[model samples]
Target chain A: MMLELISRNILHRPIRTFITVVAVAVEVIMVLVVVGLTHGLVTDSAKRVEGIGADVMVQPPSASVFMAFSGAPMPIKLAGKLQELKHVRYVAPVLLQFSSSGRLDIVYGIDPQSFALVSGGFVFHEGHDLQNPDDILVDDWYAKARNLHAGNSMSILEHDFHVAGVVEHGKGARLFVQLKTLQELSGAQDKASVFFIKCDHPDDATAVTDEIQQMLPRYVVRSLKDYMSLMTSSNLPGLQIFINVMISLAVCIGFMVIFLSMYTTILERTREIGVLKSLGASKAYIVRVVLGETTLLCTVGAAVGAVASFVITHVLVHAFPTLVILIQPEWVFRAILIAIVGGLMGAAYPAWLASRRDPIESLAYE
Target chain B: MEPILETDNLWKIYHIGKVDSPALRGVSLQIMPGEFVAIMGPSGCGKSTLLHVLGGLAQATRGSVLLDGNDLSNMQDAERTQIRRCKVGFVFQRFNLLPTLDVRGNIRLAQHIYGNEFDPHRFEMTTNVLGLSHRLHHRPSELSGGEQQRVAIARAIINEPKILLADEPTGNLDTANSDAVLALLRQLHRDLGQTIMMITHNPEAAAYAGRVIHMRDGLIVDGIPA
Candidate 1:
């Protein structure tokens, strides 16, 4: 009967239900998109770091964004010094170059055999492997957009290298080249931009990174996960703040609209409630009836909002390729909880007022 | 028969700013257990106020109401509510049926007030007796004025209260419907031996009761056997 009463109340006002549902849906969609952007950046950056196959990254001391993004050309001799460490099986020097178009891309030069060891499954898509000094492997995303593939020639810092083969990697930008070739072209024969170290034991990565950082206070070292977290914190904070504000605003407005709507309903039904009271319905029972109705409205509205949010997010992601609004299972569950809490909070005072009405006065009400 | 409801010089006064007005002035009456009584009066004669005081809906300014020898005037609000829930049933002139609830729900509402479990068989029997079985699922809006009165009867009697109070039960009905409703109340009195007190202005409606008390200026001017 409680459930039945709830259903009847919701069915009583179709227009009000529609308006509340739209409000909740807009809020949910905004929150989902914001959270998705944050998660996507963090997770994607982590995957990219893992693909680079560096257990740790060493950069200039106290250099946060600039060191990672700027990748200042370091002496190629650093790899040789790092290779002398006992746990280090092989060390590959990497260079990151910025094109005249201002697009940033990664370039790594290492022995093909050792590259496979450090990069895990990273390999050329076609053409000869990186055995010769002039060979370079470009990631598929970069290759497709730049109209450069295997056998095509491209210049980095006005130094030329042949694209030996195309490669596919994690969904981040990348371009690979032989170490000696990049060193010769960039006029950094004695320098390497960054070192990609392959350790015999993956667990030894932190110890190696720490040792390198300690050895040279001028440089910084980071585990792949930390690097990803740092990247997310700096790059995605604005989107997170925006989403939080949007969801908070929606909830506040939703609470007010739903609260006022339900209150007016209770006011109109005061006589009926009084009649019920005289008939033997307790104050608590009356409260339950009112709350039951609100819950039904909010639950149905939130469910609809969830589905609408999914559709809206999918469309937006398609329109803006870089922005993906992921509605995970957890997000759906949280939205439902929010709706229930919102419904209860909205209905409480109105139900109280209705229950407190005198039976005689209520029956006397027109 | 022993009196089921008795008031000793009940007085109900209202204060409006600096003015004091009395709705009931030292009115005293006793209603027997199985009697069907009516209080008839002009507007503002305080017949309704007397009924409200008797039903515990309003407190007396200075007096005492006794139910089965227990004093109601000194009880707390919660205690009065309990008494009202368990022993007193009320019917309004407008047939105060909750519009959102169907006939069955309206009937079950009485038990809900006492936090008592609904007895389906009792509900069915009450509806059957009230001739409202066909309208059990219909909301108050769908019922005619007379049918709404019948639903009110079912709700009032569903809990098997000690007394049923009706305030102008037939005031909204036409002549034929009013007669039908009055007849139903009379039948309920006969079949269940239930006690009832009704307030109305219509002498024709009052004629159905076993006794009628006439009031003017908050005082009873006449009492007659129907």
Candidate 2:
């Protein structure tokens, strides 16, 4: 009977109830898409790091990641010194460059012979490794996107190069050329942006990393495992703050809307509450009635939000094939939990006020 | 026999800023079990205030209301509420039936609050007594004024309370429905042997009770025995 009365009360005010529910749902969508986008990027970046197959990477001391397109150039001779270390199977000096053509684009320059070592390798879908000063490699998706194939001439960095091969997708780089060619073209001769170190024994990665740090005190050398752990929500500097701000905004939106709606409802139903009190309803019972209504609204709103998120994610993945989205089950659960908790917190004040109403006075209320 | 409902020198004051206007001033009354009593007074004579105090719905400013030996004025809100739930029932002039519930649902609400399952035998008896058997499925708005009052009465008695406090139950009904409702309430008292305290300003309504207490300026001016 309490449940029925609560449902009827909400149904009695359809317009206000609809507005409140939609408000909660919108907050849920914000949580899903904003957090999911950033989380997916972190996961994809970690996967790409693992795909590189390097036991260790060396970058500028303060840089978290060696972006071939943006980082300061390090001395290329550091690769030779790293090769002299115990368990050093290969050292590949690489340059990463970024282009803002249609969107952000990544350019990788790799030493073909050294990359095929146990530390680093690229599996080609067609054609051989770089065979010309102007030869280039691309992922299958990029080749299809740019309409390039083997024997086709492609223009990059204001120079034409033969499409040497198309590598499988998700292999770290969409575009790769010889390190010497990239260095000369970019005026970065005798300097590379980063070094990939492959160890002869995979289990000795940590030892090799420690040795590299001793040799090059000015550089930051990290094992692949250490780098992947930094790919979480907190370890990244700006991402943590972004998520925190967004989640707080979502909570505030949910809490205030539910509070206002439930408070107004209690006020409107003041006489009804009084009637219940006269019939011997406990203060706890009145509180339960109000909370029940809020929880029902939140649950319905959460379902709508989950559906909206799915549709948005589907459209995004279809429209932009390269965009990564990982809507994990846990994220959906968190969104629902936040919505319900915020709603309950918002209703707490109204429920308390309702419970405290004097029955006789309320009965006389017009 | 001890009265099922009793008030001793009850006083209730309404505070408008600093002014304390007394609604019930030193009024004491009692009605024994199985009695059908009516309280009659002018609008400002505090008949309703006395009724509210008797039913444990309101606490007296300076005295005690005892229902079956339980002191309403001395009890905490929860304790007073428990007495109302277990020992008393109330009917109002407005026919305060929950609009969302049908006749059956309204009657069951009291049962639900008491955590009691429906008693088919007792439910049928009350339905027959109130003439609400055929209108059980109708919502309050769908019922006539008198029918709504019947539903209220049915809800009040569903928990089998020791006393029923009715304040102007026929005030909103037409003359015909008023007579019909009055007669039904009288018949229920006779058949169920339940105590009833009705508050009204109408002399005609007062005549139907076995006993009538007349008040003027918060004092009983007369008591007429049937």
Candidate 3:
């Protein structure tokens, strides 16, 4: 019965209710899309790292933990020296280059034989792996995104390349071409972004990583486990700050809109509030009524926002065929939860003020 | 019989800018349980102010109000609210029906807050007597002035409160609606043996009450040749 009263109060003002609902929906969408895309970047990077089949990864000391931004190049000649170390089976030099589109369009320059050896799951989805210096292997998602099929000609980073066979999704980088070709294209032919070292045995990974770190004291080397952990960064230079800023802005948007809107609604219903007080409504009851209305509005808004986010993600993937956006369901759930909490918090102060209104003054309200 | 609603020279003053305007100037009155009383006065005569003080809706500047022996002046707001919820009910001149609610909803809102299991028999008797059973599904806008007033009466008595306070219960109605509303008020008083205190400017409306108390310039003048 209280629920019905609350629902009616909200429905009493159609335009105001709709505007509030849409505002909450937009905030929720921002939460989902921002966090969803971030997760996609992290998950894709982890997959690419694991697919390399290397027991350890080595990078220039100044390079970023996030592969997409690891621009400080390591000497390509270091791979041979690393492979000569005991327990070293193969050394694959990789150049991780970020396209202007950012992380979504990262270009991986892979030494094909060494990459195939380190990677355990390299099944091709459409076309075969990189066969020539100019051939590029695109992930299935990116392939579908960009309409790049085998035998197609494309320009990546102002350098012309031929499309190799599309690989299964998550096997490796979304866009992979010959290591040498990528190196020449970047005009850094003798420098690779990092080296992935494969150990002769699985258990030799730790010892080999320690040996390599000591040998190239200037470079940073870490076991695969540590590399993967570092890859999922919570504080990546400026990226963490950017994500936090976006989230805080989204929370503030949700909170302020709800607060102001509910406050105005309470003011509009001054007489009704008085009448409710005259009817013997306790302060707690008044607060509950107001908060209940906010909760109902938020629940509906969040559901609509979730659908809107999925639609937006669909349109984006279709529009940018090479884009990798994994809209994780858990992140959508988190977004909805965040929207609900922020909205309720926003409504609290207004509810408190409404509950404190004097019944006499309210009854006399014009 | 114990007085169900009483005031001991209650005074209510309003501060307007620099001036202190007294709405009630030490007015004392009481209505015994099961009696119907009317307070009659012109605009700003302190009748509404007195009604508000008795109803625990306003604080008196001097003296105290006792509802069924509970000293309202000393009670906390929540305590006063609980008294209003359990022992008192109000019918306003404007009908004051929630616009978004249908007739039944407006009547049930009080019981919902009272948190008592609604007595269907009393609910049926009240609505049937008010002739609002058929109009229960209609919103306030859909009802006539008399019907809306009757619905307000139904809401007021739904909880069977010990005292029912009404301010200008028929002030907004036509002559016929006013008479109809007064008739319903009288009928409810007789049927339920309920105590009622109403404020009105109309003598015809005051005639329905068993006792009439007149106020002039914020003070009550009793025994005026009615």
Candidate 4:
């Protein structure tokens, strides 16, 4: 009977109920999308880096783990020193340049011969590998996203380059160019942002990494296998805080909307509350009714938000093939939990107010 | 016989801002078991206030209300509420039916509030006695004024409370509906032996009660057997 009354009361005001549900749904979506996008980007980037087939990596001193943020600060000759290390089979000097012409991208400058030794070479899908100063290699995803093909001339960083080939994705960066050409264009001549090293055996990666770190104590040296393990949001600077701030904002939105909705509902049903009290409803019973109504709204909103998140993610990924958004089951469940907690918190005061109302005054309420 | 409900020098003062307005002023009353008593008074004469105090819906400023020998005035709010839930039922002037609930839901709500197991026989008997068996599935808005009052009456008696406190149960009905509700109350008092305390301004409505108590200026001025 109590459940019937609560459900009827909620159904009695459809517009208000819908608005409140939508507010909670928006909160859920915000949390899920924010967490999903950040996690997806990080995991995807790390996987691609691991796919580059490098056993060990060496960067300039104090370099960021995010390769896109690294500058070409290390001398190109550092590749020779890494090559001379015991158990090191090959060393590839790569220059990183950030581009934001039409879209955000990180361009990798690599010496094809050395890069092929370290990365086991790109599997070309359209044309041959880099053979000219202005030749550019794009991965399959980037080509599909930008509608590019071999022999297509594309302008990047205010410079035009001939599309040499489209290769399989998951190699480090989506766009690749000649190391010398990128170095000359970026005015970082004879400079490399990082070095990718291939060891004689996969099991020797950790030893090779230790040797590189000892040679340059201040430089960032990491085995690629270990680097993949460190690709979580917490390991990335500012990402976790950003996720936290987004989640907090979403919770605040859900809380405020539910608070207002329940408060006004209590006020509107003042006489109804009086009737309930007259019928011997306890304070706890009144609180349960109010909170029950909120829980119902939040549960519905969470379901809608979860479904909407998937739909929106699908649409986004379809429109932008290069964009990665992973909606994990754990995060979806967490988002629902967050929305429900926020909604209950929002309803607390209003439920108390309803329970504390004097039966006579409530009955007389206009 | 001992009184089913008794009030000793009941006083109810309304605190309006900085002033105290006394609604019930040292008014004492009593009603025996199975008696249909009517409290007749003009507006502002505290008839409703007396009912509220007797039903344990509101506390008195200075008074003691004993329902079946329990001092409601001396009890805590929860205790009073428990008594109200178990031993008292109320019927308001406006029908006061929960608009969202159907007639059956409203009656079932009272039983649920009483925290008792469902009594299917009693529910069917009460609804049948009130002629509300057909209207049980209808919302208050769909029922007529008299039907709504009947639903309210059924709800009040479904728990078989020790006393029924009604504040102008027919005030919002037409003449025919008022007479029908009055007859129902009288039947409940005589046939079911239910104790009823009703407040009204209409002598015709008061005529249905076995006794009448008249109030003026928040105090009883006359008491006589019909």
Top model number, DockQ: 3
Write model 2 residue lDDT over B1-226, tens digit each, in one string: 8878777888999898999899887888778999999999889999988887777778889887878989899988888888888888889999988887788888988888877887888888898989999999989999999999999999899888999989999999999999998998898799888889999888899898999999998788788332
Query: How many residue-pair clashes does candidate 4 contain?
Result: 0
Q: Give all TM-scores, in the order shown.
A: 0.82, 0.91, 0.92, 0.97
lDDT for each residue of candidate 3 in A49-134, tens digit (9 for 90 to 100)? 77767788898986667766677467888888987999998888888777764233778888888777767536787767788888
lDDT per prediction?
0.75, 0.85, 0.85, 0.92
Cα lDDT tens digits for candidate 2, A1-366: 777777877787899889988989988998998888888877876777578888888887776653432464688888888899999888887887775656666777778887767334667788778988999998777777677787788878877889988887765677889888888777888777778888887789999988888887878788888888766767676888998899899999999999999999889889988999989988998999999999999998988998899899999877775677888889899999999999999999999999999998889888
Residue B175 lDDT in model 1? 93
Model 2, runs deviating above 4 Å: A65-70, A98-102, A116-166, A175-189, B224-226
Q: How would you encode candidate 4's per-residue C-alpha lDDT over A75-156 as one tens digit per residue?
A: 9989888889999999999999999999899999999999998899999999989999999999999999999999999999
Better of 2 and 3 by TM-score: 3
Model 4 residue A219 CA deviation in Å: 1.5
- A90 in model 2: Cα distance from truth in Å? 2.5
* Predicted model with the maximum lDDT: 4
For model 2, what is the error of residue B99's alpha carbon versus the real structure, in angstroms, after optimal superposition?
Answer: 2.0
Q: Residue by residue across A1-366, what tens digits does model 1's lDDT show?
A: 566566666666778767876766665655565566666655654566667676766654455533335545576667677888878877756655444534545555555665566676565676666667766777765676677778988877566778888777562336666767766665667665566777778798888878887787788677666766666534543656766676677677667767887898888887878776666566777888888777777777777777877787778766644343456789678867776687678789998888787877887788
Candidate 2 vs candidate 4: the TM-score winner is: 4
**lDDT (C-alpha) at residue A351 in model 2:** 99
